[model samples]
Target: MKKAILYLVDEAGVIQGVQLSAELWKKAEKVVLPLLEEPESQELQREGPLKDFQTLMEYWDFTYPYSPRVRCPHCGASCEDWRTDEKHTFILNTANLGGLLVFHCTRCGTTIRHKHFKDHMSIEHTIPAKYKKS
Candidate 1:
């Protein structure tokens, strides 16, 4: 299995950052098989064949279809309230950053300055609006 870099972007044109791994990409058919069986997923297929994992993943990486929503660091709403229209970008660079990890939240406008995976997770998995002041 070759390593692959997965980039996740949310709606509002935010690039969450590239995820580096040595895993082969999963096929959309494989990923959506279970979903297609569900009533809600079936309804989605009526519009057309539900997007495959590759397409969905691509859209997530470069398009605005993905939403910038992370797990709520506090209440854990796991809903839209935790989502934001703000855009962010994540990239893998070795020259300046000198690391294989970096990410930010466009919704909250926070950046993970440290060059470490732990920092990225801290920022990515933070509670929604917890660090943001009204």
Candidate 2:
């Protein structure tokens, strides 16, 4: 089953606007009200997931040598190491000890998911509907 069909993400993420289902909205109103009261900057500036990224490196089990290059599949934007990009082209979305790191491309609305394995690292992406080309 899809996990998050309750809230709309676009119009955007983290989020420019939120469209919640009536049932869920009614229940969530209590929790969501306080969150809205002390509103903060929509864009949370993170220096990158330094500690978690380091932990993933330390436990590297991939066959190839460790490299930090991250490229957006939807757009041609590539970075040698996303964590150190001065332009901030990608934001770390998720990372875990399970060897999966998800990054959101700043140049395009595509999500880059890197799954590290013992033999190699598997990479994949999900582009937002608005950016889908014919």
Candidate 3:
């Protein structure tokens, strides 16, 4: 009987796999089929909330339609009391600003702005209004 191979490759191009007899491959496929059809969100839920620094840094570039979990970078406070300010920039009868979503953290009064781009966004941090920068 012929055999089937299942290969798993990582980002670094390392590969691993198993070659199984036709009969065993059928059984393995039955077990792996259900997992392949599972929703991606279900898998992410099992991993819990992602708190990696790179994830947070890439928040503005998130392709998901929903808002990401945002917290005060300084005080680590929740988003409940944060104030949102959407700024539109205009230049001599032309609107140049794509969009800016500014979240003012109430706990520590830090201002964070996410600038919208054509396909993604960029984040900016500003000093508290009360503090003077020399």
Winning model by TM-score: 2
Pick out the ten consecutive residues of candidate 2 with the lowest summed lDDT.
36-45
**lDDT tens per residue, model 2, 1-134:** 33423544554365445566667678888998887544222344364565677787788777888667999888788899876788777778777778888888776758899998887888999998887786
Candidate 3 lDDT tens digits, 6-120: 6677788778555576787688888977875442222111111122322444553445443433555655555422213221110011112334555554435566665656567
List model 1 lDDT by residue over 1-134, tens digit each. Answer: 34466767989768877665534435444675676444221111111212232243343333234333443334332334221322212211111222222223332433333222323422334324556588
Residue 20 Cα positional deviation in candidate 1, in Å, after optimal superposition: 48
Candidate 3 residue-wise lDDT at 68: 37
Give candidates' CA RMSD values in order.
22.1, 12.5, 18.6
Give the higher-lDDT candidate: 1 or 2.
Answer: 2
Candidate 2 segments exceeding 4 Å error:
1-48
Model 3 poorest ten-residue lDDT run: 87-96
Provide the TM-score for each candidate, comma-separated: 0.18, 0.61, 0.33
**What's model 3's lDDT at 89?**
14
Residue 112 alpha-carbon offset, candidate 3, angstroms: 0.9
Overall local distance difference test of candidate 1: 0.34
